[model samples]
Target: MWIGSAAVCLDDKNRILMIQGKDLVEWAVPSGGLQENESLEDCCIREVKEETGYDVQIIKNLFIKEGQAEGGIHYQTHYFEVKLIGGDANINDPDGLNI
Candidate 1:
């Protein structure tokens, strides 16, 4: 199973912060699979900073879901509302994804 965590941040105008990256896929909130021993909150914060260069604090868990994709790939994802603490809006994704 793929365990993931995503961060939800809103702009000053209350617009949702979405990212369009190298995948050329649909725009999505900053998210990724968790590393061993990493908490969901930590993973959410790390993914947001890594993908969008924004330091974030996990405010709360907005929702959690699990699903099975084609080819039997299962996923468990957690979404959290986050507060921006610092950092620029520039992208510097460790995975080479552009924001």
Candidate 2:
């Protein structure tokens, strides 16, 4: 099983932030697998910054999503609502999932 974290960011206009992977045509929340020795909240914050170039702080955890994929790979994801702190909007995904 794999565990991951996702960020739910909102602007002053109440619009939710979303990102598109370089290889994906669909839009999705900024998310990533939790790194070793990292807290779930830290994982969520890191993913948002990496994917969207936005520094954020966790407001609260929203929910958890668990399921199995076609390959029977079980996964658990933690979602959190985060507040924007600082940083310019740009893509800098280390996974090269952004151009």
Candidate 3:
């Protein structure tokens, strides 16, 4: 099982920062799995930064979900509400786009 953290990055305009994965082409919150010894909060912050180029402050844990995908891979996902601290909405990696 893989554990991952996602962010609903809300801005002053009430717009959420969503990302479009190059592979998936679906809009989703910026997210990624935790590294060894990484806290959930840290993972959320790091993932958001890596995917969206935004420094985010986690406000609160919002939801947790688990399910099996088509390929039989199980996923455990954690979602959090976060506020953007700094950084532009630039895509640091070509794998995804900040929308």
- Maximum-lDDT candidate: 2
What are the runs in model 1 whose C-alpha is more than 4 Å off? 23-25, 97-99
1-99 in candidate 2: lDDT tens per residue?
999999998889999999876677898899999999999999999999988888999999899999998899999999999999999998886886553
- Candidate 3 lDDT over residue span 1-99, tens digit each: 889999987777988888876657678888888789999999999988888788989899999989997888899989999988898876776333433
lDDT of 3: 0.84
How does residue 8 of candidate 2 score in lDDT?
Answer: 92
TM-score of each: 0.89, 0.93, 0.85
Q: Which pairs of residues clash in candidate 3, taking residues 3 or more apart in a chain or in different chains? A: none
For all candidates, the clash counts are 0, 0, 0
Q: Scored by CA lDDT, what does every candidate get? A: 0.88, 0.91, 0.84
The local lDDT score (0 to 100) that residue 11 gets in candidate 2 is 86
Best by TM-score: 2
Residue 30 of model 1 has an lDDT of: 87
lDDT tens per residue, model 1, 1-99: 999999889978999878896658789888999999999999999998888888998788899989998999999999999989999987776766455
